[model samples]
Target: MNTSHQSFAYTLHDVTCLFRKHFDRRAIRYALTRAQWRALKAIRRREGMSQTELAEFLEMEAIAVGRVIDRLAAAGFVERRADPNDRRCWRLHLTSRAHAVTDDMEVLASELRREALAGVSTADFEAFERVLGKIRSNLSAIESGTEAGAEFTSS
Candidate 1:
């Protein structure tokens, strides 16, 4: 019954899929799976994080993230060492090679963003981002069983 909601859903899904395809095209050259790349980015952002912490940040299972870290270590893109304070935990660190790849991934993401916003005006984009942020906050509140948002809904 609501054409506007349908349109919003379609555009959001389409844009997300398109962005993934674009990023994959650019990222394939680095020979890293998307999971590996994401793990690398997270590790780079929070160097020396234990694998369990990284999994929580990534919202992935610890075992799955452990496998990714294993591959990354085997490829020499990352090194995992026993935590000084916690022997059972393996702290992750990106090698120089992984650092370079993550840096390039940022450049690629910037280029993709530039292309996606080629004709959008700054004001319009800022408004769009503000709306998205508001929606995100609203959903976060809902998830936490707090007050549901009524202000943004149609009358």
Candidate 2:
């Protein structure tokens, strides 16, 4: 690649690295990995979500989701109950400890987000969100093979 292209790639990698570093440092006090925290928040939004549903919502693989659940369960941050209507499925629920951690996590995340967007105005933020949404949609369409006239497909 050209020098400019290589520089852009390194910049992107640095941004990703910094984001993960900050998130891990802040989230460690809650005794959760980033994935575990995301799963917990999703469960809090809609309790009793099946593993498959959680995986779909997070755009993650079922096995990866299961690993997060396992860690959270072992730490007493979540409970996995057998789905009443489907014996084959398990429903996820946040424990009391998880709820307590969520409040602090919310504050920490908000502060971090504020710092990240320190100079951005509300309008700018909204525009950024819209652009991000479009990018996400475009990537999803490509991944699903639904872009242009292609039929829907999944990897």
Candidate 3:
């Protein structure tokens, strides 16, 4: 790879690490583990998602997601109700207690965005986003086994 590509890779890794550290620092008061916050946010985003679907979305095993759900339910941050149509599955929902914490998380995210983009110009940011989208599309195509009509399939 060229120097420029190496620099970009380094920047991405550093920025991602910094952002995670920053968020983890700010989120300590909630007493939720990183995985718990991720699960909560995912459930909050897609209320009523089955545990299996949430597991898939989180790229975790269904058993692992179930354990997270159990912990969250114990904390009163979320609840799992029996799926009306699927007796074998449970639908997850965020409890009222989680709403305020999730709201704070959103505020923290917005503040972090502002801090990160402090000096970045809108045009430059837009171009950066476009490039990122292209890269993401290429990676997704490769991951999905659909690159350049490769005639490959995977479950």
- For each candidate, C-alpha RMSD in Å? 1.8, 6.1, 5.5
TM agreement with the true structure for every prediction: 0.93, 0.76, 0.90
Instruction: Candidate 3: list runs displaced more than 4 Å.
Output: 148-155
lDDT of each: 0.90, 0.83, 0.86
lDDT of 3 by residue, 6-96 (tens): 5776888899999989999988999999889999899889999998899899999989988988999999998889989989878899989
- lDDT for model 2 comes to 0.83
Lowest-sum lDDT 10-residue window in model 1: 146-155
Query: What is the total number of backbone clashes in candidate 3?
Result: 0
lDDT for position 91 in model 1: 90
Top candidate, metric lDDT: 1
lDDT, residue 6, candidate 3: 50
lDDT per residue as tens, model 2, 19-51: 778877988866667788889889999999999
Clashes of 2: 0
